[model samples]
Target chain A: MTETSGFLTSNGMAIDLTDLTIDKAHKHLKSRDFSAMELADAYLEVIEKKNPEINAYLEIYDDVKKQAQQAQEIFESKEENIVTGIPLAIKDNILIKGKQASAASKILEGYTATYTATAAHKLIEKGAVFLGRANMDEFAMGSSTETSAFGVTKNPRDLSRVPGGSSGGSAAAVAMGGALAALGSDTGGSIRQPASFCGCIGLKPTYGTVSRYGLMAMGSSLDVIGPITKTVADAEIIFKAICGKDKYDSTSISGSINAVSPKKEYIIGIPREILEIEGIDKDVKENFEASIKKFESLGFKTKEISLSNIAYALASYYILMPAEVSSNLARFDGVKYGLHKKGANLLEDYLNTRGEGFGVEARRRILLGTYVLSAGYYDAYYNKANDVRRLIADDFENVFKNVDIIITPTTPTPAFKIGEKVNDPLSMYLADIFTVTANIVGIPALSIPSGAVIREEKELPLGLQLMAPHRGEHSLFMVGSQFLGE
Target chain B: MITRTDIEKLASLARIRLSEKEKSLFPEEINSVLGYVEQIKNADASNAKALQKETVYNVMREDINPDESGVHTKDIVDEFPKKEGNYLKVKNIL
Candidate 1:
């Protein structure tokens, strides 16, 4: 799309997807300026060169050349919509018929899709190129991409550091310019945190806004599929295209983009309790203040809102999400079609497959979920957590009743080094504290790259988040885009 | 507060072989998290009946009746750790 049109090299290999925006490529191709095959060949060269270091993709669709040949005909005929043969990456959790939908897990290691995931189908119908399956956490269960049965996906910004997860590869691909835009499923900060860590924009549309029919289930109530893009506008455009009712997914909502608040000023609520956690990174706090100052400058009124249940969000999320994840993922045990190992009987095969398939982090959550939902402990844990989930939701509902939007740091800190917190599961889960509430309350939230913080060990961007009532994404987008100085 | 034994038992039930190294790390983590859940144990949830759990059902549509879901079996076989002719190769079952 840019002057460096052909394949280029980054991270020691050829990267064809870099600088490949939908707008630039289409404009040139439609005007008889360039051919689609040439563009595909250019990217193929790049992928061949740069894929070793960035390993963002799991399967590189070799037949893409044929698809490009077809698209070239359309471009020659002078018809190119918003996406016409634009190369894009789909997270492995979502199925694209005929492509392997492993979710990067060993159990379902090579399973191909019988039905294409809804979002991928829509993107394909619009002429978006399916580059390949991107790597992700096994079953979309962990925050860091490390949990992926596939090896870790490094941050394109800094090779040694992580890209963030469970949609880490999706964010890294977009950040490293490997893909124009990537569709990632976010549940408890998966999309937003990785985007922040990689210095890109991640939008978690209102729950049920995007269909999740084929997305590998993590927390069914919390999981949402949204785009991780370089700019908020691109994120908004992608959100608009894939959102709406789908017969395949009953969770899909009839969310309207037109419920945009036109007020010149908005009341923004900041809960002080969330900010008080120890080890809250200094740079994130500073960027948050500066971001708030900018919002105030834009005529937004700020208040320190008191919603007492904030302290318990992380606890409630761990309990409730794992319970849902445990139930949703129960079907993946060997017999149905994920992983199968030979055993003297069916039981050993099921146990071995799951044992080998899931990562430590995933195993921990599954165990916790199984415990909480077990017969004796149901009232003490799961039922009580659900009760608390209500309290947290009520807190947000009441807060939104008085204010138009709520803002917080999308994550407590920027991306830590690859192994910094992986050894400690609680610390890793705590990293999601700022984001878990949006899922718990079922509200729309957006995370925009606020500013970069360069620590001695690492330099990554911090995210300033804006949350709105359910179906209030337009306002969240407006405020987030406004804060990012769009 | 969840004890180390509780974390260990949960780990065992979940079937992840938590080495002593990890076992030591979780007691504190689980407790700190459960401490937060304890507060929610006291929230007024009389009206939370519907908001907490919604019964979900699969919406099955008329089959495409194409005999198969259209997935290639080759790709699926190739992804296993090890494989044989049209089969997944693994450790002996018996």
Candidate 2:
């Protein structure tokens, strides 16, 4: 036994899982430095200590030991995968059979998943240990997890601020070292934004790259499942494991991560007009600019580009996403599954169940969706938004012809105080201003932690977002790994 | 400006019951969001083809008799608020 005595611990346990990455964890398990049970215990100890204050995990899976035992068996049998014995946090939206998968909505309260998500199934197949279901924005509707019906997840770096959402809890779990990595579903910046706020690496693979068979439907076309990890290489490992076509998810494609013609002298495009928009914090902008300078120093060239229709991305995303939301969420009517409320009639039952089941933001979006897709307004709002979406995609296609990737700040600011923008729905919607474009265009994007800036005496980290063309996750990994010095 | 009547009409359309307070507050909130999204009307998409509907084709699989297979029937039936055998018991519509 190698002893595995190289971690900082407060309780004086022989092992500390906080600082161990997947590679190190797997190495230790293989070398018998520490048993997988010891690693799970270390994480459990920390989770027991810190989870209450942070509200990161909705449920710490009871099967942690069972899963670790299986992984330990795999390791002992010399059949270990990269993720074997590594604990991972799963976002609440992804279904894990026999476990409560609430999507942070009361409608799904006490609801157990019938079958496992393909992405999660793949990870479990590779011998990964699932820690628990992490909290999220209720139905992934909000940019901050304050909207979660389960309760807001406090940022680990600063208790007052949010960890970003709707994957806030997943990011927080990884950031606080409660889990080595996490699976986060991104629909308009949920993964990347939270990762940026929590000082971790988050990737949103191309729309069809990761199967969405069991992820709760947010915006069907735009939603994607990705990883949140401490390092880009770790993110890459999880992404490769989870991404590919699944028989259950028709939208899923057999993605090829290795197929990329890497640019000799990579050109990073900056839509200066979009960057010049107001509301971006000075410190955030300075940090972003510093990242750009660093990239330049590393021999990558920057070019000014114009995505003319990009200014309208946020507006377009809101319209289209809500439209999809209203349609996809129509499945949650009282009769079939989830919360059911009795009423005078079937219609009354639906109304009461939905109204009572859905939170404020969810109800608001459903109504907005109905209004936009309504008869008189369909051509004006819904159709126009779809066209503008195409125009946005066209802008990306036009730009990527010259540049290898597009770079922007993940969000306008770092972590903001919880309840800061809750009342102002428009302002809250703007939290994803920089991120919705990638989802709109169906391209892969990565948020790499650039550095931190002091906000209210707390060091809040900022991220630099790099967007690449469809099936261009390898390029993203290349640039991300280079930026992270992995 | 969206009136309270419009908000009520939208609630009815969406099949979501709303409180009297929500009926009053939602108009202002929904209008504000709609007002922000009204910018899409300015985009020149007259010639742009609607790819969101057309380009994305639904994937089809070889026919599998789900009813006979009883694959997810139990899981689906278990969620019904009122159930009898395999049927989801609902209020009499007829």
Candidate 3:
């Protein structure tokens, strides 16, 4: 109920940016409590005050006021939808036509999107005001935002700590009150881990629910576009708007896949093998147990289940993800869009352009991918990884039949210090241990703020992840809303 | 283990030019990563079915010209790094 004083309209109607949710704002806008222009100005004021320190937004769109003006017109015409005038921060990887989407890598610097992504286009159709493009790890590769060519996005809670990536800025922008919600792509824990680190709700819907036509491809098989929001209901609102079949992306499924009715009670499955993994923070484990107890107290039953191939999920992800990255990124040669460097010959042109444009981590992944897919090692590395991926998927398939949902800690630890895992890539990869399985199995996963743990005298947020069967987003929302008391 | 020579070959195959510093450092870094993921080799996946085995199917759509298709061909062409008129100019393949 705390409201910032300066965000008042001419009629003295005050807007509360700190406690504003999509539904609240929609009701307020419909009742003429405040105009959409006023709402956007309020967020712009906060971003102006906070972004320099937080480094959450890479670019604040020049057309925000124009977009807000259009949204106000919709309100006047009484045609405003739920998302009309709701300001959102888009990850740099998801394109909006005429906007620059770099994916936080120099490789695609100055690249203007010729076409908007299906998800962003959906938001545009709903009259959502795009606040800005948020920063992320270059090409959505690193778990920490430190890999961004622009800069690392600091966690709003503690300026010294990282906002976990590769959707770090999207999460930070929401946490810092810059945007109501944001869109982020999860290849492996990109959206959920960052949301967990920044104390927000992030949902990665089933792999085919959201179209990937314009999301910068990282891992084609694993990548998904989802919402990062302040509340579970807000996340569901954005997901409903964006999820559906698209002729543009053949993999997209109909939105009706979420039409399943909510049950009276739900069963929560806990993977014993994942919790037994090494290097999980003591506090995170404790927080997860507390969350299970909270769910149990709410009449949800918890059962311990074993996923035999869960141990290899991360390894499978690392191999399969990089292999896909190598193939997808091959389009960034000198002749096409994005940064280009000229050389004496065609071969040298490709080498020079890619070498100079890509960051160290990007190059490293490309090389790793190339090595795995190489002729001699193809069967040994790439094929073997695929087989393990199948096994991991099978493990989830069998488990879902016994339980309605699975739960785990979103990340092994809360947000680490900005530079804690930068020099060590392996350590950074470990951050996705609990999150990668959802991506590997192509299921819907939701990460909600469980509670906070005090670290260094600052309260750092922790999150618990709930994963449902394929296209089981309704169950996730039902349990998530009950858990968050929304 | 990935050697420096192997790193060079990968960089070459990937069409990326790595500096000598990268060449020297990547062997160790890639080896560590490969070492971690190498555990999958021991996984027994004989009973597991291939991904997309039943799901893989061609999605056919009627072909349409760029003008009729609603695709912004001009915008796509405008993104080319080096363009001569409407055609993208690339280095000679021969």
lDDT of 2 by residue, A343-444 (tens): 988888989999899999999998899888999999889888888989999889899999988999999999999989999899999999999999999999
Which is the better candidate, 1 or 3, if ranked by lDDT? Answer: 3
Best by lDDT: 3
Q: Which is the leading candidate under DockQ? A: 3
Q: Per-residue lDDT of A1-486 in model 3, one digit per residue for the tens?
A: 112537888679878788899999999989989988999999999999999999999999999999999999998988889999999999999999999999998878999999899999999987999999999999999988888999899999899999999999999999999999999999999999999999999999999899999999999999999999999999999999999999889888885766656788899998866777899999998999999999999999999999998999999899999999999999988687998898889998899999999999999999999988889999988988888988888888889888999999999998899889998899999999999989988999999999999999999999999999888999999999999999
- Assess candidate 2 and give its TM-score to the true structure: 0.96
Q: What TM-score would each prediction reach against the true structure? A: 0.86, 0.96, 0.98
Q: For candidate 1, report its TM-score.
A: 0.86
Error of 3 at A385 (Å): 1.4
Per-residue C-alpha lDDT of model 1 across residues A1-486, encoded as one tens digit per residue? 112444432323333344545666666566545566666666565556656887778888877887777776666666666667666778999888777788888868778776688877887776677677787877777677878878988887777777888888888877766677888998898888888888888889888888998888889989999998877777877888788888878788774575655667778998767778877988788888888788799888998898877777777888899899777767776654666665665566666667677766676677668777888889978887777778788888889888888889988888878888776676788788888888888788888887787767556777888889888878877777777666
Write the residue-wise lDDT of candidate 3 on B1-94 in tens digits. Answer: 8899999988999999999999999999989999999999889988766443576688888887535653687888878999998789887898
Error of 1 at A336 (Å): 3.4
Q: What local lDDT does model 1 show for residue A251?
A: 81
Candidates, DockQ: 0.29, 0.69, 0.74
